[model samples]
Target: MHKRSFILTCLSVVVIAAMLSGCAGTMVTPTQQNFKAPVVTLDSMEVAHAFGYWYFSKKVKPTKGKPDNVGAPLDLAFIFNIENPNEYAVKMENLKFTVAFEEFDLNTVASTDTMWIPAGKTNQVRVHAHFDVRQSLLSLLVTGGFQLKAKGTNAWAQLEKWWTGIPEYAVPVHVKAGAAVFKADGLTQVTTFKATFP
Candidate 1:
């Protein structure tokens, strides 16, 4: 009787072990074969910080001074949601995008920050871009001078509108030609996106 009881216990253990092994064999792993493309979307954009427009000039051009410039610094933050549908964690290597105010392209910004998005989960990335009034005016003149004239508006008018309205969420800001690089298990994917903000 004792021998029979020991044999039954051993058999039960063997059966459980076999079942666990089979389940393990069928379980999915995060590998190149099972990787899925991740999705990126602009969640939100806001004026992080801004100093209203200002200009300064020295009437007496004292030979030792910087050029007369009218400019203010504006900081904008963009938040993006990255969704990973694969069974493995993916790393975002970099992200780049061009910023447009109204219909004019203002500047191109890039973030080299690395982030890991978990499998079957969503992660948020916040990128900040700084724009100077003087620099932005230069860019506008170079890129959109003709367009601005066609619209019957000059750089100052547009810049003033953007500077004041952006803080109040009153202007339309656009994210264009966006590209993000993601990697998982030796596989890489580049995703492109574009969005507009109110």
Candidate 2:
């Protein structure tokens, strides 16, 4: 009888220790996090051409100076930031995007579905934009910017810049977005990226 009780007691302790160890390695619930903005590189600007759209063809090589063509699509690519704080998965939805340079702004970009951001990481969202040359160029020109002329560009491109007012080369740019995130408690967290660029 004495031996049986001792064995039973030992077994109980072992079981308890085993259970505790197992629980220590268990996963925790995830929570919601805020989105972070990434630094954008705007130093090198080029006007590349696509046959039909921004990805259609390499019809024109990347040229510097000023962009003045009323033809082809314009390609602009940049990397931005998104941050998730919780261990739980956050579902990103309802993204509103704006791409602006100085006083020029475009509010036409939209996303239909949600983007998944895993827990505890700042995800870099690299955006490659395809803009209509006619609209984009005309926008800058009409907003008081002069045609920028790069040395290697052809004369037609040089003469073609539609901006007629006194040229302002220095412009500030902004890429902002309003994002909504689904959190752990079935709650919605909304955040905005609000910064202007050099």
lDDT, residue 108, model 1: 88
Model 1 lDDT, residue 179, Cα: 95
Pairs in clash, predicted candidate 2: 30-87, 30-88, 31-88, 65-150, 66-148, 102-172
In model 2, the number of clashes is: 6
The lowest-lDDT stretch of 10 consecutive residues in candidate 1 is 54-63
lDDT of 2 by residue, 2-80 (tens): 9999999999999999999888668554433433322222232222323432222234444654443445544555455
What's each prediction's TM-score?
Answer: 0.80, 0.47
The all-Cα superposition gives candidate 1 an RMSD in Å to the true structure of 5.7
Count clashing residue pairs per candidate: 0, 6
Residue 82 in model 1: lDDT: 91
Model 2, position 45, has a per-residue lDDT of: 26
